[model samples]
Each structure stands twice: as structure tokens, then as C-alpha cells.
Target: MQNTPPRSRIEIDRLRKIFLAEGREVVAVDDASFRIDDGEFVALLGPSGCGKSTILNMVATLIAPNGGAIRVDDAPVVPGRPIAQVGYVFQKDTLFPWRTVEGNIGYALELAGVPTGERKTRVAEAIHQAGLDGFDRFYPASLSGGMRQRVSLMRTLIARPEILLMDEPFGALDTHTKLDMHSVLLSLWERERQTVLFVTHDLGEALTLADRIILMSARPGRVKADFKVDFPRPRDAVKLRETPQYAELFSKVWHSLGEEFAKGRSA
Candidate 1:
């Protein structure tokens, strides 16, 4: 019998991106390489303008890279052709002001031509999962920032994408709300087990959610370090911070990350 070769859910090799700003070329990412296996949650950590979001945009096929290659399931990522298996959540909630929570969450299903009955059922389940049951009829304008983001998250999750790309999804929330959002995300991830590439500059957020942390250097981003987060599964995002182990690892990773921050400041 022939053995099957190992395949990664997402593979990036020598990925480079350059942006033209004011008629000058600025390198965003250079020689970046990484692989995310099925169901792994990885965090891309770096200071602002480190090309973290740029990488996610490239993976989602929102933009073409200036050099190198990105592969999903061993297939090259082509510009203008979005991978159906991927979903993205941006920094903002981006909810439609006119749409109620239920309507927003079910929008994707409707777009896919799912029957109204089926869409309602799925939307109800997603609303429940996101803890927005009673608020289903409420518009995004009325919901709190955290609540709005929950709707945005469920909106993408309802599509059941195999890969999730989140770009600072909770960055706008206050500390308390951010922690709450963290718990919600952790619960959803535990249940769904989607391969996630989360981009954030917040170390605690990364440490709380990721199975591994891929630290990127300042401008002209490159892989600075790959740190495995050995914290056990089904993590309580809030309680994890109190553990001595969490603090130790935080210190270690922060040391490396802090250096990049300093470099970014100097530049």
C-alpha cells in the first residue's frame, strides 16, 4: 500500500510583497515562509506596519504578491481568484447598519442561495452560538462594539470556511470587552476547529488564543521567531493569564517581540 504524503492546510514559501507609495517602492514582506497544518490556530504577532495584515490579504487572494508564492492545499493562490475555503474578519466590525443581527449573520447563506427555511435555521444557531439570541432583531447601530463584532464573526463562521483569517478583530474593544470577546472566540474555535491565522500586536491576545505564535519583524516583515504555545486546549482565555506558566512564556515571547518594537521605533 502506498502512504499518503503530509499536506498542510496553508503553505507560504518565500512570500514577498512590495507596495508602491508616492512613486516609491516599499517592501512590505520579504522572504516570509510558514505552514499552517489543518485545524491549527496560529497568531501573526508584530508591531504596526509589519506586513501582518498584508500577509493575510495575500492568503485570502485579495491582493497579488510582488514575489514568491502562496499555496492552499498545494494549489497556488492566484490573484483575482479567492479561495472558497477561506473567510476573513477585518479590524472593524463592518456590520451593515440597516441589517439586524440575524439578517447579517444569514447574509452569506442567502448569497449562496440557501433556502429561506434552511438559512433561518442556520442563522438562529449562529446567533445562539454567538450569545446574541435576544438581540437578533436589533440593528448593528444599537449593539455595543463587542456585540457588533460577535455578529461580524458569526457572519463569516456561518459559511463554515475551513480557514479563518482575523485581522485584529477585537482590537477596538475595551479591556473588559476584549476579554469577553476572547472567551467567545475561544469557545467557537474549540467547537469549530478551523485553521485560523489571527493578526494582532497584542501579545496577551496571541498568547491566549494561538497554538503557536509566529513573530514578525518590523517593516519589511520577516519571520522573527516561531514559538509554540503549549497551553492545554479548551483554554479559559481570562483565567489563562493568572497562571505562572502563561506569565513565563509571556515574558519570553515579549522579550523577542520587544526588540522588534524597538527597531520599529528607531526606524
Candidate 2:
């Protein structure tokens, strides 16, 4: 039997989020709506604490929206349902201490009922895909921070989820390592073409990897500006950073967000 490919990977319709503060109401996301086609790379750009992760969380089904709805392949995202369609790599690595790299990567598949006999091959492939080929036997405690993150990414990729919800996956790495990871990730994405929703505060990172940039407003985020990245694929991050158009695009988004920041709405 053959499985059918997903039609649309993610659809966020009129998504709204609100939080109760000490004594006031906080709207984390205000009527936000967007769509990501299967195999598309989209970046959700916003300031810190700007509800970027909130939106990502909503899509990941980690948190339910106060208003509106999110669906993956026409199926509504049921709250707390294990999020099988989504492979989330959070800002930090959440690998288990007792698990080896291979074990960590195979965990999700195990939960999904993948036979133990098939786990090793899939885990090995995921390790290679994540550029952690020789580190499979290493414990999480034995690896560097960036390496730990690789393990996390490999774990997520091994599951072959329809959509990847990445919240600042590279935000914690050093500049050089982050650039390297960016290249590695772009290559993987180009090869697999999984629908991806990436949240980031770095304009350069977003521009380097995203097919489309969704510039979001400050806390209680809204889509302030949308830019279509005109750069050709297999983008060279270093070269793209030096291009005048790249600077121009970043400037535009900066100003758009600056307006919101200047108004004291940013967090």
C-alpha cells in the first residue's frame, strides 16, 4: 500500500492568542493568518517575546488559540494530540540525558510504532542528514551545545513529519556554527522540501533560508510586512549578505518593524 502525500502542510486561519497577565489582558497574536505550501520554506520574523513562538506553538498544537483555528492537511490540530504531523525543534535542545544520539533520534519513531528493526537504519540516516555522522554513540552530555542541537534536529527529521515547526533552532549557536548549521539545514530542506515554519529574530538568518519572510509586529504580533525572497536557491549566505538587494530587503523589514518598536510596543 502507498501513502498519499499531504495536500497542504499548514494553514493558520484568523489565529488569535491572548494571555492573562498579573491583572491585564495580553493578546499575544492578533488575528494572524498565513499559509505554508507543502515543501515551502517560510520564516516568521519578529522581536523577542513578540509572540513568534506563540504562533509557532499554536501551529505545533502545543497551545490552543483563543480564537480561530489551525489545520494540517485539512485536519484540525487537536490540542495535545502528540503532534505527529509536526516535528518541532525548540530554541533549546531537549534530548534525554540517558539516551545516546541514536536512541534520541529513534524515540519518536518508537512512539509512532515503527518497528525496532527499522529504527537503527532511520536513526543512522538522520544522523548523517544532521551532519552528526560519527557522534551517534555519544551521550548528550558529552557533546557541545551545537552538537546537542544537531541531535535534536536529527531526532525531529527522523520522524519525517509533514511540517517542521522550528523556534529559533540556531539562535543559541555561535556565529560560525550557526552559519554552518544554516548551510546544512538549507541543503536538507532542498533535498526533502518539507514544509517549514521557522521563527527567528535574526534578519540575516531569515533572509538566508526563507523563501518568504513574514515580518511580524511586536507583542500581540501581527503580520506587518511580507517579502518574497527573490534570490536564487542554493543561496550562499556569505554572498547574499553582501548583496545590495539583501541589505535593501533587510532595511525595509527593519523600518517596518522599527515603526512598531518606536511606538514602544516591542518586547
Candidate 3:
């Protein structure tokens, strides 16, 4: 069955979040609501400090919304620890330098008490999927920036989470490395079909990888625009930029995001 049932559903209704900074409550996200279908790649694009990461963290069950509600497959979010069916990929590689690539990828499985025989099988499959087959014994410090991040990704995948929450996972990479990671991410996502919520400030990054882009405004962030990317799959980040349709959508996102950037500056 090429079109299978959605593996999961995410619904956020009137989601709101606030934080205490300097003994004053500051609104981070206000009345935000969106739904992500099973197997969809949605990018959250907003200016820096616009609470994009805040929203991702809330949905990942790392933080609770002050008001409103979030449901993952109809289960209310009760943020205290990481959600069971969700995986997170952070802006930095969270690889344990003391652990080899194989050790890092299989760490979760080990903790879950997966038996040695089955755990080894899972780790081997994940390493191969991430193109780390021959480098399984390499330490993170010996790997390049991109390879380490790849290992980070494999570490998350080894657990087979139903949903993925990525918070600017490629933001710190150099341009060339960032571009390569985009392809790597897309390749894995295409095969895995996990519901994905990716938080990024880079519009080009969103366009290259997301099935849709949800734009957010400045402080007290809210959805400003929701743009569905009509580009077909197997999209090449470098080549997609040269197309006319890509040009049109790029202009629209830039114009809308420009307003929020200006507001952030003035405040």
C-alpha cells in the first residue's frame, strides 16, 4: 500500500507559552494553533527569538504550554520528560565524545534493554542508513561537523520514533556543509515517513526541505503565513533556487518575514 495510514497526528489548539525573564513574564507564543498530518515535513520559520524553538519544545513534551492544549495522536501533552513516540534533533550534535559512533547510536536501545543480539542488528541498520557503515568505531571528535551531525541523526533514528522535532539542527554549519546536510535529511525523511516539525530561521532551508512552511511573527509569535511548497519530491536545494516558482514563493516569504524582522529591530 503506497498510501498507508498516517503514523501519527499532531494538533495544537490555542497554544500559548510564557517565561519569566528578569522577574517579568514575557509572552513567547500566543494563541498558536496548527495541525501536522502523518508523514508531513513542516518547517517553523520566524525571526530569532520569535519563539519558534519554544513551540517545538512544548510539542516535544520538554515544556508545557501555559494555556491551550497540545495533542499527539489524541493524547494530551503533559510535559515533564521527553515524549515516548517523539525524537529530537538539536542545533548542535549531542554526540557523546567518550562514545564511539556505534555506541552513541545504540545507546538508547541499550537503555531500553533491547537484547544484545537484536540491539546490534538495529544499530548496524541505523549506521548503514546514515552512511556510517565503515566508520562505526570512529569517535565523534575524529569526525567532521557534518559526520557528527549524521551520527546524531542516526542516534535518534535507532529508536524509531514516530515523530521528529528538529530545532535548527543545521544552523551552525558552514554553507557548504549545511547544504549537504539538507540532502542527507531529505533522503532519510523520504524513506522513514515520520511526522516532522522543523524549526529554522533560514527561509531557504525551509523551502529546500519542508512540505510546508509555517511563518511566525516577532515576539509573542503567531502564525503569519502558511505556505505549501508545491515542489515535487527529491528536490535539490541548489537546483530548486533557480526555478521561477521557487522565485515567486521566495519573494512572498521574504516580504512577510521582513515585516517581523523590522518589528523585532524596533522593539
Candidate 4:
């Protein structure tokens, strides 16, 4: 008997999306294609308004693609009801103001109909994983910005997703906090080897976290360049930037992204 190959974690082929603005058709993404291997971390890095988030939404099935296909584990993605095997952490905290940290993290579990007994166990584990153990009973307003984002992470992790999609999750935090969160995210990613497709305009974040970075052009986005990060795994996000290799890659990616920024400014 022949053994079957492991299915790709994500396959986006000829993916496209268009929007109607002021009665004018605007192409958000034009023929973006890429593949992500199981357990790999990939970053979609591009200029602002380059459709990085649009493509992410398309892959998440929160929005339908105007054309082409997206598959997760070889299964077709259904629009608006994407694959449940995925978790999403957004650019801003989405915690409910009325709910305690415990309540917030358990919301998804509650919706999934997980037994209360099991949910308690899972929620506790997620809280500990996110360093929110003592803050479990606290409300969202009380936690610092970084702490709130941790709640968002724990909230998603409680679902036990195999794939995680992050769109500029730390973009609003202070530089120090952002770096800390990078460490936290990397540690969690190392534990499970979960497939991640992160969308960010931050080159440093992409270089520190991803196995590959896909660059996209300005509006009416298309794949501009795809570069393998080639950094060693189990990396230390705080120290990763100090390496000679990191500097070299930074120069290369900045050059590509710089051109896109110029195009956006001129248009």
C-alpha cells in the first residue's frame, strides 16, 4: 500500500477580491496565490491598503473571494462560514466589556457546546498559557493593553484550532510591549506547531516570527515576491534582530516594500 502525502495546511490559488467604492469597482487583490505547509508560520507583509487583511479574510472565509480558490487541509473554503479549524486574533482587542476574562475566554467554548466541566479545565489551561491566571476574574477595562491582547489570544486558543490567523495583532501596543508579545506568541507557536498566517505591515515582526514572508504590491494587490525567512527555528524574537543574517534579510525586504510604498504615494 502506498502512503498518502500530508495535505497542505493552506492553499490559496488565484485568489482575488474586488470592492465597490463610490460606485467604482476597486480590485483589492488580483490573483494572489500561495501555499502554506502544515505547522509552518507564514507572514503576509505588504504596504498599507495592499489587501493583506483582505486576503486573510478571504482565507478565513469571512469574505468571499471574487475569484479563485482557498483550501484548508484539502477542503474547499466556504464563504462567511470558514473552516472552524482556525482561530483569529485581530489588530484590536475584541473582548466583551461586560464579561470577565474567564467569561470572555469561555465564550467560544460555550458556543461550541463544550460541557461546563470540560470548559473549566480548558479555560484554566488557556489562561495559564497566556499568563492571565490571576486576571481571570477581572474585566477587560482593567487590564493593560498587552494584557488585553493576551486575553484575545487565550480566547482563541480555547478553541484548540490547528490554524491561527493574526492580522497585526500587536500593531497598537508600545514598542516594548509589542516585542514582549512577540516572545509570547512565539512560545505558544512552538508548543503546538500550529499553522499560522499572519498579516502585518511590520517587517521586523515578519522577520522574527515567520518561516516565509509573502510581499504584496499596493492597491489591486498581487504577489510581488515570496522569500523564505530561512531563520533557525525555536528562535528568540527579542534577540533575533541582532543577528547578521537578520540585518541582511531586513535590507532585502525593505527594498521590496519601499517600492510599494512609493507606488501608493504616487497613486
TM-score for each of the candidates = 0.97, 0.91, 0.95, 0.96
lDDT of 4 at 206: 96
Off by over 4 Å in 3: 1-8
In angstroms, give how far residue 124 of model 2 lies from its true place: 1.6
Q: Candidate 3 at residue 157, lDDT?
A: 81
Model 2, span 147-261: residue lDDT tens: 8988888888888877898999999899988988888888888888889999998988999999899988877788887889878888876778899989998888788877767
What's the number of clashes in each of the models?
A: 0, 0, 0, 0
Rank ordering of all candidates by TM-score, starting from the highest: 1, 4, 3, 2
Q: Write the per-residue lDDT of candidate 3 for residues 36-117, one digit (tens) a residue.
A: 9998999999999989999999998888899999999898888886678899999899899999999999999999999999
Candidate 1: C-alpha lDDT: 0.95
Q: Is candidate 1 or candidate 2 better by lDDT?
A: 1
The alpha-carbon deviation from the true structure for residue 31 of candidate 4, after best TM-score superposition, in angstroms, is 1.1
Spell out the clash pairs found in candidate 4.
none
Cα lDDT of model 4 by residue, 12-111, tens digit: 9998899999999999999989999888899999998999999998888889988999998898999978577899999899999999999999999999
Once superposed on the true structure, which residue ranges of model 2 sit more than 4 Å away at CA? 1-7, 265-267
- Per-candidate Cα RMSD to the true structure, in Å, reads 1.5, 3.7, 2.3, 1.7
Instruction: State the weakest 10-residue window (summed lDDT) of model 4.
Output: 3-12
lDDT of 4 at 61: 83
